[model samples]
Target: MVAITEMTNWAVDLIDVRKTYGKAIQALRGVNIQVGRGEIFGLLGPNGAGKSTLVKIMMTVVRPTQALGTILGRPLGHRGKLAATGYLPENHSFPGYLTGAKLLDYYAALSKVPRSVRGPRAGELLERLGLSRWGSTRIDKYSKGMLQRLGIAQALMNEPELVVLDEPTDGLDPVGRRDVRNLLLDLKQRGNTVFLNSHLLSELEMVCDRVSILVNGLVARQGTLSELTERTVEYEITCVSDVASLAGKLLRLGATVAGPVVTLPGHDIAKVNEAVDCLRSANVAIHAITPKRVGLEDILVEAMGGQDAKPSATPPTSPPAARPAGPHGDS
Candidate 1:
């Protein structure tokens, strides 16, 4: 298992970050999180769960009541370090008049990218994000998928050491989502770190190496994918024949069977071995044996105690508008 080690090289290390609104609304409660270098980290929670508020603090867009930690090895809210970072916030709005290509250049400039590199950087980002053909088209005419791609390109313009994304796949269809997944994987391969927050649990499952689930202004759960899914990880066993007698024996052992298939619903390797021995003893034809992992949504649902709406201790308040580290086009 590849993991970002707990060390001084942590890309993000925010400890006891607390935020409150007015007199009683607590948005964050001692939120402590650590992200490793060159890893795709996913943060998850329902609406008004301080997910947005936490990310805003990272970009220094919203001041936390109290936060003591380091980001990219610098103190929290260190502006000089932000120049090397890329950010794509949720509900990001771009200038409607600018073409897709121009949009990238504008955001890049905000990151303080040199003039010599902006043009080439913008072109390369457009092409990589599959927006090369539509570079000349205005954003007002672009589709939802196109706009999402443009937002990603804008974040990458500076070739940042670390990138922060919030709900990056908000409006994308399946095919477009696949493309985004591929792009994220490519970024990881290039040794850049990604810190992601999204409501789409499946998308996070596909790309995140580690995840933290924040519920009611606190981190309810946090770990690697395998660690998070440890409780419900399952294995499957398949046999070629639908032998009735063997089915009964396996059934008594609590295995689910469906015509030549037996599903052992636990992570125990021994049970799998026991099932295999039973099949062999019964002279049943053995077909295949494999493991099936649980989904992140299931874990999240369990973590939140099966709640459907925002599980907040306080009433909802308007969150800050999503904005990049620099002038992210228009508000």
Candidate 2:
């Protein structure tokens, strides 16, 4: 178990959280997670890893067998703090009879937002989410992607300081996903803390400031992306000439040769230099030398004990956008 340390700067602090069903099915063993204020934190795990259960516990939607911590600096289940928080649950079911605008107003009212504040906020969020033209359209008339967008808009109706989203981009296409990523960044710019739970590792890699990997209800790993991937740094050298001939020499220098490429694990520059020198001595032409850090998918695979667990479908790549720097200056 990872030791839990109390920190006052956290927007969400969870300690020793556990949940069980019918005394036999342990959904969560013991989990500790901390999210800094004004940052985007991601929660990722394989199916039945208690990701949704944990989120529900945080949102006061499901009762936990044991839990201790604070949300927004207040004790668990604090009414005022909960009112200040926003949440969008997984597989949400909204009333289809209500129009998009009416739905936002209804949700905001439930959060105790003033009637006057609800209208303007609803309009602003509708426009922000690209639903201005569909404001009066009934939710049943909206597409799956549009409903997902409306769900996110309703969560922000109260202008929460801490937003907990479960699969916010589940039904979104490439463009919709890109828009959601931008919206998340905009929330961070406004000093809002976001706790994101999703199965899409690529999307999380693009936006999360830090992440926690859970396995069988336990936290297998947790930290900033840099912290988690630091040990996974490796260098790949592609050669025009066959690398088989130099395998024996490169092996002595802690490098593996396969076909026309040499793989060197770790960040040892001297080893790479020696390998290059060995290849040069053999008159092998070098095509490219690339450095890489293992991605979130790689980390998740390792956490799952090398099992062949598939994450959600990866969306098409889009142009990179400017992102906020994480604690380690990487995002």
Candidate 3:
């Protein structure tokens, strides 16, 4: 059952969403997510974490057991709002007989974009996505990277306010991935909301303004990259001279010594300074000192390991307050 609430400024707001596949298999436990307008929000998780199930529910492709929220300021599955949104599924299949331009035209038409606008829009999107030369080429003749690019172009044909993409760079090479990253930033600049579902941690880290990590059908962590990685995990000091002889003394100071490196666990600046002083007094040649923080991969691994154990660093703070709508109007 879904309860329609008053319209909101959020591009996507889901609350207590749940789904059950059979009599016993629970695909999604209670899950809640909020995406601000005009931001690139990334969804991440290991396989079987219900990431796809949540996205399908948002797109109305799968019925939820219980849900409440708004998408684009209207109730879920609202036709007008649906028309204003675009989606690219995980393994989308398009007709092989259609040319690249034709496919874009078809998708745009389905989105109710005016016939007069489709042609110019198709051409512009093809060029923007590096498919101008392949506009007239049959999709069957396109390479995997080209097909992926075409799929992205199709998703933007309507100039949608909200674009939901699942694995947008699934088949692209490094350069292609970089291009997609740039394109996502461009969309944010145009005040468009993007909900990205992908397994590529480094890519998400670079592009996403905020992210949510789902583990075992629940959101284990959700926040901006800086908020999530605010705590310094450790400090590493690299020295030109071997420090293996000082292992016992360094260990006594809550640091570990290996070869020419001295590692101080946790965010203790005083301890790090003490180690540095010790090395300096010993006439050790220090090369560099670096502080390390937990990244997205580290967060994901910790989430998957469950919250029972003590985390290596402080947990992320709560998500920030709702942001105002962008220039594109209420999301």
Using Cα atoms with residue i matched to residue i, what is each candidate's TM-score against the true structure? Answer: 0.83, 0.87, 0.89
Better of 1 and 3 by lDDT: 3
lDDT of 1 by residue, 1-331 (tens): 0122233888888889999998799999999999998999999987878999999999998999999777787877777669878889999888899999888888888888998999998889889888999999999999888999899999899998889998888899888889888988898999999999999987998899999999999998899987876453455555666856677788876788887768776666677777777887777756555555445776677678885422222111222342221111110
Decoy 2 TM-score against native? 0.87
- Candidate with top lDDT is 2
Per-residue C-alpha lDDT of model 2 across residues 286-322, encoded as one tens digit per residue: 7666555667887898899986533223221222342
- RMSD per model, one decimal: 12.4, 6.0, 8.5
Displacement of the residue 174 alpha carbon in candidate 3, Å: 0.8
lDDT of each: 0.80, 0.86, 0.85
Better of 2 and 3 by lDDT: 2
Model 2, position 177, has a per-residue lDDT of 99
Error of 1 at 116 (Å): 1.9
- Name the candidate that leads on TM-score: 3
Q: Candidate 3, clashing residue pairs? A: none
Candidate 3 residue 41 C-alpha distance from true site, Å: 0.7
